[model samples]
Structure formats: C-alpha cells, structure tokens
Target: MKAAIVPALNSPWEIREVPTPEPSANQVLIKIGASGLCYTDVHITKGAIPTQFPRTLGHEPVGEIVEVGVGVTSRKVGDRVGVPWVQSGCRRCEWCLRGKKMFCQQQIGTGVQTQGSHAEYMLAYADSTMLLPDSISYEQAAPVFCAGYTVWSGLRFADPKPHEKVAILGIGGLGHLAVQYSKAAGFETIAITHSKNKEKLVRDLGADEVVADAEALQKMGGADVILVTGNSYKSASAALKGLRSDGRMVLMGISEEPLEVTGDIITNRSRIIGSMQNGDEYLYEALDYVAKGKVKVISETYSLNDISRVYDRVANGEVRFRAVITDM
Candidate 1:
C-alpha cells in the first residue's frame, strides 16, 4: 500500500509503499474513498501538535468497510462510513461515561496518535465510525468529519434560540458550513469576515447579512452567539465586542495569541468557550444536515498522489475552502 508519510518535522511529505494494516478486535478496515486535508495537518508537520515522526496526518475520511473485526457487531462489510478526529476514547473514563468523549484524557486521535486514513486502506474502531447516509457523497461527507463536525458541534453547544442572531467568524471551510447550519437551525445567521470578497459568497450560503468586521457586527444589534472559526487571535479577540450582553462566544480554531479578557467582556456577562469534535452522535447530525441538503460543503478535490501539493495549497490558503483527496 502507498501512503504519504511525514518522516520528520518541517519535512516534505513522502509517498512510499508501506505495509497495509489489518483490523484488530473491535476495529474495521476501510477502503478510503475520500480524505479531507485540514490545516491542522500542517500544524502536525510543523511539530505544533506533538505527534511522532513517520505519521500519516489525515483524519477526515469517508470510505467503505472492506472487513469488520469479529467483535464488531454494529457495522458490516459493504457499509459506507466516516472516520472522524476522535478515533476512540477509553470507555471507562469519566468523560466518556458522561457522553463527553472528546474530553476523555485517554482519547485517541485518528491522525495524531495513530495511523490515519490518508491512503487506500485505514483502520477505524467500529464504534467510532459514522454510518454515512447514502444521499451524502464521499467527497461531501469527508469534510463533515472534522471541519463540519467542529462548527456544527460548536453551534449546538452555543445553544442559540430561534430568531437569535448567530455570527460565524471567517468565511472559509468551517465558517462557510456554520453559516448554513446556523440558518437551518432557525438562527438569524450573520457572516463576519475581514474579506469583502466573501460577502457575496457568505450571503449565498444562507447568511441573512454579511459584516466586514466585528464592529459592523456590533452595529447589527450584536450576535447572540459568535462562532470563531478564524485562526487569527487578534481577529477573534477584537470580535469580543460583537457579542451581545450575556451572549456566548465559542472558539473552534487554534490561535497563537491569547484572547484578551478585558473588563468589558466581564461586565457584559459574555461567555468564552472552546469546543472540540464530539462523539459519533454529533458526526451523525453533521452528516444528516448535509444529506438533507440543509448544509453544502464546498471543497476542491485532488488525487491521492497529489497529497503533498494539496498540503502546500492548504498551508498557503490557496484552496477556496476545504480540500479533499479522492481518486484513491
């Protein structure tokens, strides 16, 4: 089997023939149909995520089950599934017992801790794999595993009521899908971005209005819930003023700088929170929305052979939104 391996930090991705892995107890083997390339892969390559060398750094994959382990009863061969960020969590952990699997300290990250789905075949725990709806194609289902799941889970956790304004920061990957989800969930959707070029695109994605910056968002009665999807700490911090009194702000992207918690943030009783990918339940919800046409995942498709080139595009922000490696 040919796979892209990161031999070292800050090194180029190498596609080499490696032995394909077989499914273990409670695991299933998947023939990958499409894999989503995320910016976090760049972080891993730069040694920011602290993964071991010679790793395959892709987690968002949609594929078909080629074989199922003897202990796996929930899934069978010939089933279509999606492998998400959280591969598996220790079932005995308190967080996992409470249904908050992402918070489990013993969680296993698909690409970060173990071999990931960047090749023709990858291993996924049967319990962690999401059964993809037939209506959702592999290309569309791929990004929902990570980018879509993150934003959708964040928005749900924010818990905005009907008619409450929800502002999605950034117009790329996650933000684009957040706009659609926010609208479908009955929130008065707003798109906040520094780029004026995305105004039209965001509006077309179901946003009720587009604001150039956080200040403009404040002028529109402020957002009841602000979902931060941009990677810039400065931009996210400045957007604090856009939150309405007692509103909540969810950070879904990683930022280098700390968010300034000024007196104003405290006086307004605004809440700042961070959310990661949830359990299989959230993944199913993300896919359900996509299957029903409530959300549209915009992505550029690349062949598995061009994994390195696609990584370069993602790192340089050249891809319009999410990039998926298909044709495996």
Candidate 2:
C-alpha cells in the first residue's frame, strides 16, 4: 500500500510503500477513499501537538470496508463508512457510561493514537465506524467527519432555540459549516469575519447576515450564542462582547495562547460557556444531518503526496475552507 508517511517533525511527508493494515479481531479494514486535511495535521507535523513519527495524519475519513474482523457484526465487507476523531474510549469510564466518550479518561484519536486513513488502507474499530448514506459522495462526506461534527457539537452546546440569533466567529473550515448547521437547525445565523472577501461566501452558506466590521456587529445588537472557531484568543474575546445578555460562547478551535475573558462582561451577562467535541452520539447525529443534505462540507481536494503543500496552505490560511486528501 502506498502512503504519505510523516517521517519527522517539520519535515515533508515521503511518498512510500507501506504495509497495508489488517483488521484485528474487533476491527475492520477499509480502503480509504478520501481524508480531510486539517490544521490538526499541520500541528502534528510541526510538533505543536504531540504525536509519534512515521504516523499517518488524518481523522476525517471516508472509506469502503474491504475486510471485516471476525466479531464485527455491525459492518461487513463492501460497506461504505466514515471515521471520526474519537477513535476509541474506555467504555468503563464514567464519562463514557454517560455517553460523553469525548471526555473519557482514555480517549484515543484516529490520527494520534493510531494509524489513520491517510493511506490506501487503514483499520478502525467496528464500533467507531459510521455508516455513510449512499447519497453522500466520499469526497463530500470526508470533511463531515471532523469539521462538520465539531461545529454541530458546538451548536448543540449552545442549545439555540428557533429564531435565536447565533453568531459564527471566523468563516474558515469549522465556521463555514457552523453557518449551515445554524441555518438548518432554525437559528437566525450571522457570520463574523474581518475578511471582506468571505462575506459573500458566508452569506451563500445560509447565514442570514454577514458582518465584516465591528460596526456591523454593533448593528446586529449582539447574538444569543457565539461560536468561536479560530485560533485567536483576541477573536474569541471580542465575540464574547458581542453576545446578548445571558448569551453563551462556545470555543471550538484549539489555540496556543491562553484565552482571556473579561470577568465583568461574563459575570454581568451571566453567560453559560464552554467548548465541546463530538462524542459517539454527536457523531451519529452529525452523519444523519449530512445524509439528509441539511449540512454540506466545502473542501478543496489534494493528493496524499501533497501533504507538505497542504500543511503550508492551512498554516497560511490559503485554503478556501478545508482541504481533503484523496488516496487516488
């Protein structure tokens, strides 16, 4: 099997032939169709996130099951599926027992703890694989496993009711999908971005309003829920000020800097706040939305051999929204 292997931190991925992974007793082997390239992959390559060398870096994946393990009852050969970030969790943990597997003490990410779907073939635990609807193409469903699920989980945390104004901060990968989900879920959606060029794109994604300046945000009179999806603490902090009384802000993007929220604003408004990723339940729900065409993934496709180039694009914010690596 050919794979683009990450040999070392800050080094280019080498296209080489690697052994095809075989399914274990409770796992299934998949012939990867597509894999989404995220900032997480770039972070892993640059050592911003800890990961082992020679690892395949991809979590948002779509593939066809080519081989099923002996005890894999839920899936079989020829089944099309999607794999998400939460690869496995300790089932005995309290968090897992309560259906919050993303918070389990022993959580394993697909690209980090195990080899991922950046290759022609990869392995996944039967329980972790999602059945993809035949209607969704593999290329289109790739980003839904990560960026789509992340935004969906973030919105779920916000718990917006019908007609509530929800603000999406940053119109990048996660934020783009956040706009769509907010619209489909019956919220009055707004997209906030400093880039004037993205205003049309955001509005096209079903955002009721698009704000390119601070004054525009002021005109909207603040939002009931604000979802911050960038790596800037400043942006997150600014969005906090743009929330209505008793409004909440969910931080979804990982930032290297410590976030500073004004104590006065938080206390005075009595805002409920936190960040969340998709648990097993959320993943299933997100996939359903994709199947129903309520949510769509906007991505640029690249070959797996173009890993370094894609990483540079993601680091420099060159990609339109998200980039996916096709294993062709």
Candidate 3:
C-alpha cells in the first residue's frame, strides 16, 4: 500500500509503500475511500502536538470495510463507514459509561495514538466506525467525522434556541460548518471573520450576517452563544467579551498557548462554558443531520498523494473550507 509517511517533525511527507494492516480482535480493516485534512494534522506535523513519528496523519476518514475481526457484529465486510478521531475508549470508565466517550481518560485518537487512515488500508475498532447513509458520498462524509461533528457537538454545548443569536468565530474550516449548523438548527447565525475576503463566502454558507470588523461585535448586542473556532487565544478572549449574559461559549480549536479570559467576563455575566468533541450520542445526531440534509460539509477534494501539500494549505489558511483527501 502506498502512503504519505511523516518520518519526522516539520519535515515533508514521503510517499512510500508500506505493509497493509490486518484487522485485530473487535476491529476491522477498511479500504480508505477518503480522508479529511484538518488543522490538527498540521499541528501534529509541526510537533505542536506530540505524536509518534512515521505516522499516517488522517483521522476524519470515510472507507469501505474489507474485513472484520472476531466479536464484531454491528457492521459487515461491505459496509461504508466514517471513522472519527476517537478510535476507542475504555468502556468501563465513568465517562464512557455515561456515553461521554470523548471524555474518557483512556480514549485513543486514530491518528495520534494508532495507525490512521492516510493509506489504502487502515484498521479501526468496529464499535467506533459510523455507517454512512447510501446517499452521502465518501468525499462529503469525510469532513463530517471531525469538522462537521465538532461544530454539531459544540452547538449542543451552546444549546441555542430558535431566534437566538449565535456567533461563529473565524469562518474557516470549523467555523464555516458551525455557521451552517447554527442555521439548520434554527438559530440566527452570525459569522465573525477578520478577513474581508470571506464576507460573501460566509454569508453564502447560511450566516445571516458576516462581520468583518471588531466593531461589528459590539453592534450585535452580544451573542446568546459564541462558538470559538479560531486557533488564537486573543481572538477567543475577545469573543468572550461579546457573549450575552448567562450565555455559553464553547472552544473547539486547540491552541498551544493558554486561553486568557478576564475573570470579570465570566463572574459578572454568569457565563457557562467548555470545549467538546463528538461523543457517541453527538456522533449519531451529526450523522442523522447529514443524512437528512440538515448539516452540510463545505469541502474541497484532493488526491491522497497530495496530502503533504494539503497540510501546508490548511496551515496557511488557504483552503476554502475543509479539505478532503480522496483515494483515486
């Protein structure tokens, strides 16, 4: 199998032939159809986040199952599935028992902790693989494993109601999807971006308003819920100031720097907040939304051989939205 292998940090990936993995107990071997390139991959490549070297760096994967191991009964060999970042969890943990598998202490991420879906064949725990609807294409289904689902889960944290103002910070990968999910969920969606270039693009993706300037934040009377999707602590702190009293703010972007928030911002307003990834329940809801044509993934498709260049594009914020690496 040919794969783009990252042999070292901050180095270009090399396309090499590697042995295809076989399914282990309770796991399945998938012939990857498509894999989503996320900012996390860039972070891992740059050593901003630590991971094993010689890693195949793709987690948002859509693939066809070729074989299943012992004890796997939910899916069959021919099933088309989406593999999320969370590969598996210790089901005995309290968090996992409560269905908050993403919070499980022993959770293993597909790319970070194990062999990921960057090659022709990949292995995944059968329990964590999601069966995609026949209607969803592999390219479309790829980003849903991470970007789409992250926004969906973040919205759950915000708990927006109809007519409520929800602001999505940074109209890029996660923020673009956040805007769409906010609209589909019946909220008044606003997209905040520093780039004037994204104004029209953000509005086209269902944002009721696209704010290009920081002054626009004050005119909105503050948002009922703010989803921080930018990878900047300063931007996130500014967003906290733009939240409505008693409103919630969910952080979806992982930053290397510590997030700085003024104590007064939270203490005076009684704001509730947190970060989240898709868990078992949220995963099902996210897929259901996609299957029903509610949440849509705005993505650009690239060939698997172009994985290294795609990472550079994502790191430089050159991608229109999400980038999916298709196996061609």
Q: What TM-score would you give candidate 3 relative to the actual structure?
A: 0.93
The C-alpha RMSD of each candidate to the native structure, in angstroms, is 1.1, 1.7, 1.9
Residue-by-residue lDDT tens digits, candidate 2, 183-282: 9888899899888888788888899888864357757797888888887877777666677777878888878777766785756574646666656567
Off by over 4 Å in 3: none
Q: Could you estimate the TM-score for every candidate?
A: 0.97, 0.94, 0.93
Q: What tens-digit string does per-residue lDDT give for candidate 3 at 1-328?
A: 9887899888898788999887889999999999888888888889987887988888888889999999999989999998888877898999889877778888889888887777888899998888888888888788888888888898987777766799898887888788888888888888888888888888887888887543576576878888888787678777777777777778888776677767867575746466667566777777777777876788888887787788788989889888888864
Question: For residues 1-328, what per-residue lDDT tens digits would candidate 1 score against the true structure?
Answer: 9888989889999898999888889999999999999999999999888888889989998899999887999999999998888877788988889987778888899998888878889988998888899899999999999999999999988888877899998888889999999998888998988788888888889999998888898987999999999798788889998999999999999978978878988799999989887556777888999999999999999988999899999999999899999887
Best of the two (1, 2) by lDDT: 1
| C-alpha lDDT of all candidate models, in order | 0.89, 0.83, 0.82
Which segments of model 2 are wrong by more than 4 Å?
Answer: 213-215
Is candidate 1 or 3 superior in lDDT?
A: 1
